[model samples]
Target: MYDIQTIFQTANPILNQMPYPMMILNPEGIVLAWNRQAEKTFGYCAEDVLGKFIPFIEEERTYFYKDLWQKIIHSADPLHLESITISTKKGEIVNTPITLKAFTIDNDRYIFCQFNLGSEEQQDLLSFNEFTSIRDGLESSFMMLSIDQEGLISYANNLFLKYSKWTPKRIIGKTFWQMFPQTPESSVVADAIWKSLQNGRQWKGEAEKITKDGQSYWVDLTAIPIFTSAKKPSNFILLENDITDKKRLQNRLEKIAYIDQETGLMNRYRLEQIVNTMISENHHFTFVYFSIDKFYSLKELYDDQAEQVLIQEFTQRMKMYFQDSSMARVSIDEFVVLTPLGEWFIQGFLTYLEQHPIYINNSTLPLSISGGITKYPDDQISFTHLMKASYAAIQKVQSEGGGSISSLTKADHKALHKKSVIEKRLLVALDKKDLKVLYQPQLDLITGKITTVEALVRWEDEEIGTVSPEVLIPIAEETGLINDIGSFMLEQACLQAAAWHRKGIDLKVSINSSVREFRDKNMVKQVRRILEDTDCPAELIQIEITEKFALEAEAETSIIQQMKQLQNEGIVFALDDFGTGYASFRYMQLLPLSQIKIDQTFISTIQYQPKSQMLIQGMIQFGKSINMSVLAEGVETQEQQDILTEFGCDAIQGYHISRPIEAKEVEKLL
Candidate 1:
């Protein structure tokens, strides 16, 4: 029924496309055909084997051939052998697989023979012993899988089945994602495998996969794509090894980054992360920053061993009281507590803390905290702005004598930054000698003549311009710049006084000195040097100290000694702003004979405040009794001047008499 010409046409094309060698023969055992592939593979050409008995099947296998032909004739299908031995044209033997067929065409029989791929001799490939060793090594060392081009599993090695806990039957034909079901991670792996095959490349990576038991494990995977001679992908050989333990260790290492090792609390780094996350979520929260007052002093008293103990105790206390809040230790004594509580609760919490105390080291230390409270999206929307604003408010509160909490107002923020800028620029301004000195005259009440001039410092910066003496003085004192400024004040006043004396000016010059500068043991020598350098008689230079610093400088024996030494050198003293400070009669009685200046507050209010008038009269009587001069300052009007003159006040200084003048204008007064 089948045509011989049609069968040969179809069969010839198929055989030539195969990578195997084959020959064809008539049923009479005469060679009929030999293809180019068979000739090349067996080291024989088509001319050598075309009409010859098909070599390699061997003439010696005549009996076996007869049996094979008989079987082929009986079976309607092609007869196949999975493995066999065959001789090449050079008489070399090969380990191979073969297929044979017999067909009847025009009442004659023809036979076809073919050999399987990679069927070279056993010696040419791996020897039997080496093949067995390699197979054992692969099974023990790797979890291997064979996936077809469609990402469907065709085979899984014994190790893969062991770790995945999947039977061979359950794993085959399943997509990679179906077996793992941990996508998109598993899907990610499948994409990587397919991409490598698509580009004819290999792929390797560490990935997470789920087992049949639904447990996750990490593995290092390596995929190799198998391709045909035409560069078309066929299957992928994927190898993996368990790396779960290593992954866990890496996770722990990453977790350590967010933890504070000292106190077992979240650190500043983690705090920033959470705050930014909450900002992106549009969550409302209050950032409350608290600092313990004089924490450094406490640390010194407690010693190094107690540092960690105190921090741990502080964190525990915060965790206990603020159970619902997120607290982070940003520094040794600083913490940021984030809460969703109302402003009333925050205010109430601060009040309660003032009443209670934290107990540690067998002593109850008072818990006084200065805090800054800022609301997210209310005070600032960015993490940096919120943090900066909160801390700035706290700094302002602490500088004004702590023990309180406050929210940042726009004005407060501007004032704080202004103060900071002034503080920084003042340092340079001082170095550049950019400050000016002006003299306010002090008039003698009885004589109606100017008796002395008080030197006052003024500063006008090129950039910030015109810093108030009230603001600059405090910053100078806090930063220890007062000593240098005080020294400059002394030298300039002495020089000007000497210049006035040269022009026949008989008035004295008084320079204000800070309590800190007054307490220095070198105060006497510094004044003496200035007077000597200026060639000004010591009697004309009076060092004026306010009543606020009355007892502070006097408390130190060294300062008391220096004052007495300078007083003996004809340098007089003036108790400036007398009524404003808490100086007792004892300070006045024990001090060398000098003068007292009534503060401006009493003079300004004398017309209405009868008590202030009485206080002023009593002060005059007391000064006279002590044989010291009494001076009234800020005599603004005739009535106030008349009252002071009637009270026998010896000296008066006020705007009514003269405004503060520059050194060039001093000649008119002289």
Candidate 2:
């Protein structure tokens, strides 16, 4: 089955240059190839040995040579005979040492023999039979393959065929690289092996290989380059042990410990490991964090099975696009990727999404993703700090309404660090009841007396000093701490109003509320419980809401119902910053609003800007026509206050009257 002529012809030049005799023979002792050196050593020409049995071994030693031939065939490793008696054409007998190895090509087996022609004084005799016995007893337990200097498979043992599922005809004569699947990693291994063998060095490692049917298996391989007397490599011998089972078990354990089962990507722990490794090596790379926008909202629409399918497809696309990067799934909707610095493909991915939208059940879901980038060894020195910095960048995008990408800046880092500290301390402050309330009074234009006071929550931390509501409120809401702060505001405002009523000082205390507060179904009950606990008259308490809350109330009927229930209990609702937001008459009609507060933005410059005066006047007239009172804010000067008074503004609250004060100061004012 083997192309014996081709193998001999390929090795013809190298064989002729050998310093010692070399011969190729079949299992039955017939000569196949007789090199020039073999002819000189045995006194036989190519014509005499061609297709013929050996005529060099003595008749008395013929039985011993036959026994040695059988040993070589059964042994996977090369065998050597210490001495053999040979008779040349001149009838002169000589003792020679030789080595022999049995090799298979296709279904045919051949023997390669090399003879040492020098005398005992010139060459030291080795225990060839003993060495062969030891090798046959131990090394034959593993599979073997022979590769020529050109790296083609000259021969492979039955063991290789057994484990590789490859027949002799399918494997023989092929280059070593052909046995492996075509991939970057496999190519790298093949190149390394070739280089090492060419340099006359032994190569040893564990390699994963593919079988005939595409199943993967692992092998512990040792390749030794076989050299000629010229100190140049002629062929390589490979000894391999199948390690598939052990590698598979190791892979399973690694999968459980380092893989995200949902998407088959690296998990958070694995990402941390890789990042730490990179940091130790001082390898500069960018860490990019990705978050799917409104992921939970989309997830709620699908069942668990469909969600998993969607997630798999999403990650598959990522793998294809970012083929060179390392990626990990850090959370349910968050993923991270590590790439060379300045080589991020996120912008390209965003563009790709525009052309290809992910669909489910024939419907295009509103899918958008955001990314944040941080450089390694540039932004942070450690993996934990790097991840935190990247997350801060992501938070910036999320806070700005998401669906975009951003990189961490020095300024952003400082601001985000401050925000984190504030958030943590704010929790402690709430627990300690360190937050206090101040009241800003509203003066009735006709009565010339304060009629209502707006309760504003203020926080002063021992570590962070005073944190403005503008900075702290958004953090509280984002962190879900606004519910606690809102509840505190309602309780304190009700208690203060009750105290003032008991003192014969009639004042309606208004407390601002966020739309998020009403997300809790127990908000109405909580307010009622607070009023009852304080024994405050419902008429003396007012809940001021912004136009944003009013806009949401339009769609969320439950919030509007809650407002009406509170209003029915004799509590009042005023739409604050009326002219500053959407200012939709629809929400104004949907909600049971007692009054509309003209935003300070319009009243602040009403005295100079006639357009402001016109808008203010129109707001007041509209409020009165709708049977709702009008109040103007930020009346900082008498001219501004008098202008509002002239415009028929029912009430005004600002510094022009008096700045916000504590409950004691309000008592004195009353």
Give the top-scoring candidate (lDDT). 2
**Error of model 2, residue 62, in angstroms:** 87
Give the per-residue lDDT digits (tens) of candidate 2, residues 406-476. 88778876776687789889999999989989999999999999989999989889999999999989999
Writing each residue's lDDT as its tens digit, candidate 1 over 1-670 gives: 1243333433443345445576666664555655557777777776665555555566678777767766776565555677767677678887777666665544666676665442222222233346445866766788988888788999999888988888999889988666555557678776776787678677777778778889887777777666555566677777788766555534432233344545566777678889999999999999988887778777787756566666776677677667889888887688888999876777676666545555667787656678889888776776666677889878989999888888888787666567767878988977887778999988876676777899999999989999888999998998899998898888889899999889888678898888799677678888888889999999898888777666765566677777789899998888988888885666665555498998898899988889998999999998889888998888889899888888899989889887889977756775
Q: Evaluate residue 143 in candidate 2 and report its C-alpha lDDT on the 0 to 100 scale.
A: 79
Error of 2 at 526 (Å): 0.9
| Clash pairs, model 1 backbone | none
- The 10 consecutive residues of candidate 2 with the worst lDDT sum are 118-127
Among the numbered candidates, top TM-score falls to 2
Task: Name the weakest run of 10 consecutive residues (lDDT summed) in model 1.
Answer: 118-127
Assess candidate 2 and give its lDDT.
0.80
